[model samples]
Target: MTKTLFTGVLSLLIASCSQQDDRICEAVAKAPNTISECVHREGYLLADAEGSIRDVATAVVEKCRNHIIQQLLSKPENGPSLEVYATAIEDNAVEEAIRRVTEARSGNCKKPE
Candidate 1:
């Protein structure tokens, strides 16, 4: 019984630690600021077909969409599936994430001075 309890506790600890190690997962698990930073570090800006500059964090977000969905779904509040979340952010989603980071950066990031 003691061995089983110890193993369960150890498993939980390991899982928590592993989640912290994943930047994208951590961001999704944390506040908006962290999410913005994570997006910024993994994304950039690009000119859209409409000749407007946009953040390209959508690709990064998409790349980690599955992980993000899983993490979010782990919480009782976010009960959406991966496909639902993907559809919501499919259009310029990375750009939106990048925009958040850029907004928070306030000219501190790659934005031209």
Candidate 2:
């Protein structure tokens, strides 16, 4: 993406940080599996809009989801199922944070599929 487009996107995301955090957090807290919670959170994350921006965001989302799942899976004793809800909250927080950071960084909007 051009620097201007990247800047515009990042600016858009930075401007909207606080608004989406709560919803994302809630979704993350209740998710079951990494992919499941990710899928759920992703829906919440992309609650609006269409087109390549959404497509690019989806791509990054997989990475984000895996990152969360890995974190949750690391503690097998707790088991992903047992602690999924609480982890979802954290996952949401982390995801939102990632969105903000990515927006600011605004890497190439790689298509998810």
Error of 2 at 105 (Å): 8.0
lDDT of each: 0.45, 0.50
Q: For each candidate, how many residue pairs have backbone atoms clashing (under 3 Å)?
A: 2, 4
TM for candidate 2 is 0.28
Task: Give per-residue CA lDDT, model 1, range 1-113, as digits (tens).
Answer: 99999999999987764332222222222222333343444443321212223424445575546545554555445656766655554444565665644443333233211
Looking at model 2, residue 52 earns an lDDT score of 53
Instruction: Tell me each candidate's TM-score.
Output: 0.32, 0.28
